[model samples]
Target: METTQPSGTTKRRVELRITRPTLTWFARPTVTIDGVGHPAQWGTGTWAVPDEGGTRIGVYLYNRVWRFGTATRTVTAADVSLVYRSGPLPVGAGRLDAA
Candidate 1:
């Protein structure tokens, strides 16, 4: 969906679907867009897109001791759907792709 921001600039949104295996130990996922952090839960979530194209997105699971299962991607489509799938091992990079 798209909405107008207070600055009169039009902003868009992208749907983010996140999932992980059973061994995350209750650590939450953080979705970072354009260097800003946003707390995310499992399943579907939405993030506001400040720019329509060339938006940077990153996802990682923080277990307090280490930050792993990290993924990053750049989006250029007007309507986009992203998914983050954690790796089997917690110390590896996660899969992030368009869905």
Candidate 2:
């Protein structure tokens, strides 16, 4: 990602799209030098993403774990719009403003 610069701030802006997916299963940390997947429990971690064998990844910092894998999830402003459009849980009739 390029740092924002005054000269081309608007032109080179990255449309960062973030989609808050459903809370996934608690992932157990694992490691595989070769092509294998192992499950780590409670307090273990390795560099691996959700998928892609070995590419994209998410670092579980608070949990104190870091992983590396190939599974890049792109989020966009539009996506956020869609998610909120449905409104917060407890199921509403879908509104821009909900009390």
Candidate 3:
């Protein structure tokens, strides 16, 4: 939605909820809006280190977080800006962008 500003400029408001566990780390990710990078959501580490091994080798062990629901969001009002709603890939892995 948008509204006319007192200065005759346009003002827009957008509400986004990143409830996905996969998106809660390294701060929020960035997406392009009008050729600009915008932080919209976040994610946490997907792979937990394995306590079985000593050190380096133990890090190989990884796991996926469980999910309770799924969702998606977008705001392409002639701006092609997508805020990316929920399930936004795991952090620390090659999950960002394309997996």
Candidate 4:
């Protein structure tokens, strides 16, 4: 469900598909929308964001040692579906693509 902002505007949401080659993760993933961090799980999730253009979406996995599998994308008003694929290795950045 969409949330109502203090200004009474319904917050926009986007569908995020998160996946990694590994079976498990020590810590949950984080979805950062416009710099705000939201905890997320694997598979599919819906995240609330501002209802405006030029929104930046970022996803990353945080292990106990360090944060990796990072990716970022700038979405427009009509953009919604997104998929974040973690890199095979834990050191480099991942891929974020429109789905």
Whose lDDT is higher: candidate 1's or candidate 3's?
1
Ranked by TM-score, top first:
1, 4, 3, 2
Candidate 4 yields a Cα-based lDDT of 0.82
Between candidates 1 and 3, which one is better according to TM-score? 1
Candidate 3 C-alpha lDDT tens digits along 42-67: 43222222223221111110134332
Which candidate wins on TM-score?
1
What is candidate 2's lDDT per residue for 42-86, written digit by digit as tens? 322223222222222121201234332222223232222111122
lDDT of 4 by residue, 14-64 (tens): 899998646335746899987888888889988767788888999988978
Taken over the whole model, the C-alpha lDDT of each candidate is 0.84, 0.25, 0.29, 0.82
Query: Model 1's lDDT to the true fold?
Result: 0.84
TM-score of each: 0.85, 0.21, 0.29, 0.84
Q: Which stretch of 10 consecutive residues in model 4 shows the poorest summed lDDT?
A: 1-10
Clashing pairs in 4: none
Locate the minimum summed-lDDT window of 10 residues in model 2: 78-87
